[model samples]
Target chain A: MDLVLIQLLNGVQYGLLIFLAASGLTLVFGIMGVINLSHGSFYMLGAYGALTLTQFTGDIFLSLALGVPLAFVFGFIIEWLFIRHLYDRDHLQQVLLTFALILIFNEAQKILWGSYPHSVPVPGYLQGGIKISQFLSYPYYRVAVAAFCVALALAMMFVIQKTRIGRIIRAGESNREMVEALGIDSRLLFRFVFASGAALAATAGIVAAPLESVYPGIGEPVLIISFVVVVIGGIGSIKGAFVGAILIGVADALGKVYFPAFSSSVVYALMAAVLIARPGGLFGRAA
Target chain B: MHNKSRITRRDALKMAGVGAAAAAFPFARPAISQGAPLRVGLLLPYSGTFAALGDGITNAMDLYVKQQGGKLAGRTIEWVKVDDESAPPKATELTSKLVQGEKVDVLIGTVHSGVAMAMAKIAREAGIPTLIPNAGANVLTRAQCAKNIFRTSFGNSQPGVATGIAMIKAGIKTAVTYSWGYAAGEESVAGFKESFVAGGGKIIKELTLPFPNVEFQAGLAEIASLKPQAVYSFYAGGGALKYMQDYAAAGLKSSIQLWGPGFLTDGVEKAAGAAGEGVKTALHYVESLDNAENKKFRADYNAAFKRFPDVYAVQGWDTTQLLDVGLKAVGGDIKKQDDLYKAMRAAKFNSPRGPFRLSAAQNPIHNFYLRELKGGENVYLGVAAADVSDPTTGCNLA
Candidate 1:
């Protein structure tokens, strides 16, 4: 029973972290109608940024504070220079352009950081485990990360469902022409959405950096998993992503413990089952 | 003027005849001259995850050549390099290009075991003399052993067996085994189980997850509940760092002893920080091995590379040393296959890792040291198994 409870927590923590990465991809695909294959690269940039900034600031939180805005600006520039041109193109063209960006970002990371794996230090305060029982103690840093992700999810929900910008964002997602026809600058709104999405993924990377090793190609795995989450949750539904992420995470955790041999295929199996049942996704609109 | 400048059929026929003769003349001479350069193809990863390892091996090999005044066994060396990208699917094509296309007389490679397996199969079929610097797949020197192929690195199971023996000697009778679900992991655990069981130890459980996956929460929780006396695991590079961190973070580090092959702490110790300390492991080489050859190699490597040499560099250096011994015995006549293989198989030299020689299966027979991680370094504790030799299972050498 204790094992099951702990595994559930593990699944939830993992799911929330991945939700941060997948939400950005779904938003870009949903709102801008652009398949940004390089969404994972933004996550990589955040981790590397945290690695560099923490070395200078001597604190992980301070590094997070500085890295998010820098990532926002970087994403804004990337959209203006490359992604904006991709909006009007076909999915194949968008995929090609974004895939090329993935390759470019991977090589650039190698040139800048070399191939050695690095780790960001958890701050002194968040360095130990919180005892749950006689045999179970969860790391304080992991608990803190889970709480932060929950807070971010709530804040995001409030903005997208309750604010003026949120309304315009949803309006653009449903019909870009109608949003533009209402005298709103859809292009500028899109730029903001893409940048904010980039920042969200980066924020995940920064917080998760201390939890795992930061290395070249670290983002590729996260990217692949996030795509699965997006597809399972319906491409543009943040609520769906949340539900999908937690489901996959919990399923993956339990599967690994009980079915060690086929653990790697568990998430894919869940996705296949979901797709077979729903055709679209649990929250995805019919095509 | 245009008609005069254009090539006539007669002129083209004459040029074709000349080209045919030029190509055929080389085949007429059966043997290469003694002083001619020997073509050595280096099929190793120059990009991807193992690039740093590839560079280390290449640099050390080049350093040895430079030390020998840019020649070996009275012949200048010609190097041909192809980046394998550490992708196994591309290995056969790359090996063929090096052997059939470039006609390299010798082959050296590879950091990834999967790529090395493919390269070895091709090199064995082609009957090319191949040296493996880093990959430690046991099959290379066990079930699939070939006369033309030699491995300078230890087998994947050697360190695990050493660790098992060390743990039994330390009086730990109950333990669990954990590793990535791959051939290397399985083989290492098999080795550990063999030794541990022989020494009257009982295994509590065997846990595994997918290769290269760092999510260890579920696995760690299980370990905490089961409460084994010790845990033996196999991981390297980034995965190793994360495993150590997770183990320490779960509060199991104080109650359960963690053991693994030395790769558990080898290259990622600094990044692992406090989580890596006090972990015991067994390996064929440590930076602090106290020996005359090791001391000299360390000084020379530091002087040349401007950084401290790791186990990969030591393996690379030994590879060249073995090659030098073979070439000197054959007087640089690479075509003397019988004599060259005999000399290479009989090679005995003092390596930086200690006295090195080949087992009957042509894998390295050397000491496995028991070491503990202290302050981001593998502090040598003692010899876990001296001059350990692999069992050479299923190797007929036919």
Candidate 2:
């Protein structure tokens, strides 16, 4: 039973990490209404940027401070030059354009950093073990990461629930035509939201870089999992992204902890079960 | 008396001429060097998920081809390569193209063990020779063992056995392994488990990480709960990098030592970094090996590539070297499969990975030494040898 408790905690921790990754991906799709397949590419860039910045500054917090803004700036440039034009295009076209961006990002990353995984070390302050109990102990970094995720989740709720920007985002999600009919430009709002979403992805990437590897094709797996999150969460729902991310995370983590031989397959099983029980996700708006 | 002396000298010269003629005649050019640039089909992973890893191996082989003057023994070594994508069906298709379309003389390469097994069948069916660089799972030599197939790689079990024996000798008591679900990983784990158990060590936990989706957090957590003395794994390439970093973050670095099948060479150092510090694994070649032949190969290879040769590059270099030695043994008389096979089995070639002979199963019997990454290069500690037999590998390799 203690082992089960430990695994549940492990699952929650894993879920938190997945939520950090999937939240930004959900916003890019939900607010923008254009499928950004390369959202994970932004995450990868953020990780790479964090790696470089941390190495240069020798401070992980300062590195993140530097990377988050750079990610927004990169998103701005990419949006203005490449992604903005594809807004009115079909879903297939959007997928193709974003897929093309994936190749560009992968190659550009290789050309800039060479074909190797850059090791991102965890900050020295967060580098020791913490005692969970007399018999069990866990890494403080992981627990701190979980706390960080909760803080981010609270911050996200504040930004989207109580702010003027949140009102505009809600207007945009409900009815795009109606949002434009209010005499306020949705395009400018979308561009900013999209850019902010990119920053969120970068934030996750920076936080996870020291934990996971930063390498070529690194963005692709995350991108696919993000898609799974969006579908399961019901597109255009931030609350659903959180719930879906946690569900997937817990299912995946527990599956591996208890039944490692069937780890990958477990996520799909949960998705299947969710589809049967709740077709529109836990907090999704009804059509 | 002078005329008699001159006649004897002429007779001796005549004999010398006859001997020189016989010696040079086989290696001597016949208006054209190399026999029709014997087509060597490369069944490789050029266009797939494994493309990135395959790219390095393919680049090394092509580098060897160019360095050998675009020819092997005066014959152009034309590469008729197909991107297997590490898929079995695709590999079989490409082999058909190589056999029928390209009419290759010998087959080489194949990163995936399954792909290698398929190509082995092609070689057997077509009466051609196949030289594998690193697909060392035992199955290639066991159930599906063919006549003309030869491997230059240390068998799959060699690395695991080497690591297991070294850890056992090092006085480790408890160990846990994070192995992927594949023949390569499974075979290595099997070898490690056997040796580790026999050497009076206990396996506290054995975790298998599935392929395609490798989120290692849960596995790391489970293993941490077990509280083993040491941890070993067979995760390679990018996956290995993630495992190492996460392993470090999971707070196992200071408490539990990391064990691997020696994927800690220059190839993986980029992915692993400081977390892989003090990591011990087994391999036939370490960058720190000091020998006249290895020194020459290193200098020459570095001068050409501007970097130290990794295991993949070494494998490519050794493959060509073995081919050259076999050709020389048969005096480049590679008109028939039997001749090439016989010469290869002799194992008279000097390899970069020290001296070892080939088993009748066509796998190399070699020393698998424990090496560590120190100061950005592989440091060979001492002699670590494991005498592996030609046990029947149950690969269903095809």
Candidate 3:
């Protein structure tokens, strides 16, 4: 019973982290009608950025505080320079450009940091474990990260559901032309959304940095899994992404424990099961 | 003035003609006969995750050459490099480019086992002198063993075999074996099981995840529930660092002992920091080996490279040392293939990893040291297994 509980917590923690990444991807793909393959690079950038910032500032939280804004600016520049031109192009072109961006970012990371793996220290206060049983105790840092993710998720929900910007975003998602006809520039809106998505992904990276240890190609796995999460959650539905991310996290964690041999494929198996039942994803609009 | 100018022009033309003839004379003779630079093809990952390992190997090999007055066995070394990208699919093409295209006399490689396997197949078929510096695929020196191929590094199972012996001696009677489900990992576990089971120890369980995956939460939770006496694992680079951190974080570090081959804490010691404390590992080389050769090598390498050398660098240094022995025996005539192979097979020299030589399978037979992580360094505890030779399983070196 204790084992199951701990595994569930592990799955939930992992799922929350994945949701942070997947939520950004779902937003960009659902609202902008853009296939952004380089979304994971933002996560990589955040982690690397955290590594550098923490080195200089000597604080992980401060690094996150600074990193999110910088990532937003970086994303704003990227959308303006490249993604803006890609808006009218086909998915193939978007994939090509973003794929190229992945390669470019990977190379840039290599040039700047080399190929050595690096670690950021967890702050001293959140260092030890919170005892649950005689043998099993959860790390305080992990619990803190989960709490932060919950808070962030709630804030995101509040902004998307209750605010004027959220109304504009929902309206833009449904009908961009109508939103533009209402005298609001949809282009500026999209750029903000894209930048916000980048910031969210970066936030995940900064928090995950101490745990995962920053390394080359770190973004690639997260990117692939986030895409899965987005697809499973219904490309444009934040609620769907949340449920899907949790499903994958729990399924993946439990699978590793129970079906050790087939653990790697368990997530894909879950996706297949989901797709078989709902072709449009759990919350996707009927096409 | 006209006469003097004409004479000077004629003299300059004469000198140019002589210089051109002197350069052309070497090309006129048959290549590889004598007095030509020995072309060594470096088929290693110059990019990607293994780039640092490649750089370390290349630097140490060059340092060795430099230490030998920039020549080995009376032949100047000429390096032909091709970045394998740590991709096995491209290994054949890259190896062909080095072997047939550049016509390199010696081939040295490689960090990834898959890439090394492909390189080994090509080298065996082509009958080229190949020295593997880092990759530890057991098949290289086992079923696929060849006279032309030699490994300065351990087989995939060698260090684990040593670790198993150390664990049994340390009174760990029940343990769990954990690793990524790959050839290297499976072989490592098998090696550990061999000695551990032989020493009257029982393996409680074996757990594995897919290769290169850093998710260890579920695995750690299971480990805590099982509550084994110790946990043996095989992981390297970033994955190793994360595993150590996770193992410590999961609160299992205080209860269950963690052990593995030296790679667990080898390169990522500083990054692993406090999480890596008291973890025991068995490896052929530790940074603090407490030998004169290792002491001098460390000092010299730090002087040259501005960093302490790791196991990969030691393997790189030993690759050159083995090459030197073979070349010296054949008097630098690489065309003397049979004699060169014989000399290399008989090679015995003091290496940074301690006394190194080839087993009949042509893999390194050396001491595996049991080291503990203390203060961000692999402190040498003692020799876990001395002059250990890998069992030449399925080898038929005809």
Best by DockQ: 3
Pull out the clashing pairs in model 3: none
Sort order, lDDT high to low: 3, 1, 2
Judge candidate 3 against the unseen true structure and give its global Cα lDDT, from 0 to 1. Answer: 0.89
lDDT of each: 0.86, 0.73, 0.89
Per model, state how many residue pairs clash: 0, 5, 0
Scored against the true structure, residue B116 in model 1 reaches a CA lDDT of 93
User: After superposition, which runs of candidate 2 have C-alpha atoms over 4 Å from their true positions?
Assistant: A133-137, B1-56, B77-107, B114-129, B212-214, B264-266, B270-273, B326-335, B373-377, B386-398
> What is residue B175's positional error in candidate 2, in angstroms?
2.8
The TM-score values for the models, in the order shown, are 0.91, 0.85, 0.91
- For candidate 3, write residues A1-287 as lDDT tens digits: 48888899999999999999999999999999999999999999999999999999898999999999999999999999999998888999999999999989986776677666788999999998888766667899999999998889889889989999999999999999999999999999999999999999999999999989887778988999998998788988888889999999999999998899999999999999888889779999864
Q: What's the lDDT of the predicted structure labeled candidate 1? A: 0.86
For model 2 chain B, the run of ten residues with the poorest summed lDDT: B1-10
> What's candidate 2's i-RMS value?
16.0
